[model samples]
Target: MAKTTPATRSLAHAGIAFDVHVYVYDPGAERIGMQAAEALGEDPKRVLKTLMARVDGKPVCVILPSDREIAMKKLAAAFGGKSAEMMASADAERLTGYHVGGISPFGQRRPVPAAIEVMALGEPYVFINGGQRGLQIRLDPRAAAQLLGAVSAPLVA
Candidate 1:
């Protein structure tokens, strides 16, 4: 078995079922999302990435398809904020303790609100990073919503 992260350990303790996938990571690449999808042989749409953003001076997590960008205006509206801006990569790394390509919402310096777009609809499963590069965790979205205190919204445009 792969070593469990604090985040994944907590998740497992909560009885959340997940699958771990590992791959060879290319540290020099820019688009880690696409790389994750390619490595796992999963469709980009089914593989989501977590992004950190500042909304009204507070940090929020946006989970969306690996292939698309978050719609700032819609995000702001959904969260009842005036505006939203992408946080600096360095800030994200510091807050999440993971590199830009491996920002998993499950483990963070703190539990920030996770806002997902409606486009990410599916049954009970979705793919998210497993707190490291070239690693991913597949679990139920409902479990994610409950564990991470995430709110689902139609934030995708």
Candidate 2:
């Protein structure tokens, strides 16, 4: 796998410190994040999953623990909307310019409102997708949120 990706480049450009970790990606895994966490031998809470969603029809990005599910109502409220839903996979792929399993909040083709789970921010470090399957970027969750201008909230169910 290539060591450099748009996600890594974005972090480098922003001067954020991070480490890249590569793992065996399971295409058939029902839960990508959980698979990633297991592959990395990290706690599920430390592996963040990037999700593309729509809040009142507007695109948004959400980051939360791999083991949790998003509360749609809370997600909508987080963005000051009344309703929210997961974006269509095709739309998400198009908007982020990445495949479903490889999508990363960083270096998205189109930037949008983003949120990070409040609980995740407490971790010393978290692993997020590195713009490709089988790849993750480890860094301080606080730094990731700050860099993405993501609002911190209780986003999980």
Candidate 3:
């Protein structure tokens, strides 16, 4: 597709197939995850959104379903950290090279610790941002970890 980013390109090279979907973005909207789910005509619980947080002062990315909220205590416990808080949007953009609403586990500016709820990977289907708002990449859950270097764990409450 669009000469994919380094992360996506690497995925392709590794034989990880993916489908790209793009939609109209509503910049004024606050619920981008819901927007994407609506545009894609998929159940919100089956789709996921990426969140950037600082775990013990280091950037980390956590992927969870749009219908759920991150359990900070669970996250902190899993990582052996005392605290985890959402990072500022500016810091998120600066570190990930993607807007807060459009952050993907792939192609981040740096290799941040990534965690995906174990439930999200129960099935083969998963969708994530394609490095831009209104754009998404659909692929197998296994491919996500292989491509994004993510750790699939139990962090969703």
> What RMSD value applies to candidate 1?
1.8
TM-score: model 2 vs. ground truth? 0.99
lDDT of each: 0.80, 0.96, 0.80
Model 2 global lDDT (CA atoms, 0 to 1): 0.96
True-structure lDDT of candidate 1: 0.80
Candidate 1 Cα outliers beyond 4 Å, as residue runs: none
Best by TM-score: 2
Candidate 2: segments with Cα more than 4 A from true spot? none
| Model 1 lDDT, residue 26, Cα | 78
Q: 64-142 in candidate 3: lDDT tens per residue?
A: 8877888987787667899989899999999988777677778788868888888888766878887777877788887
Q: TM-scores across all candidates?
A: 0.91, 0.99, 0.90
The RMSD of every model to the true structure, in order and in angstroms, is 1.8, 0.5, 1.9
Better TM-score candidate (2, 3): 2
List model 1 lDDT by residue over 1-157, tens digit each. 3548756876788888898888777787677787888888888887888989988878999988788778898888777999999999999998888777777888687777888766675645778888877778888777777787777887665
Displacement of residue 99 (Cα, Å) in model 1 is 2.1
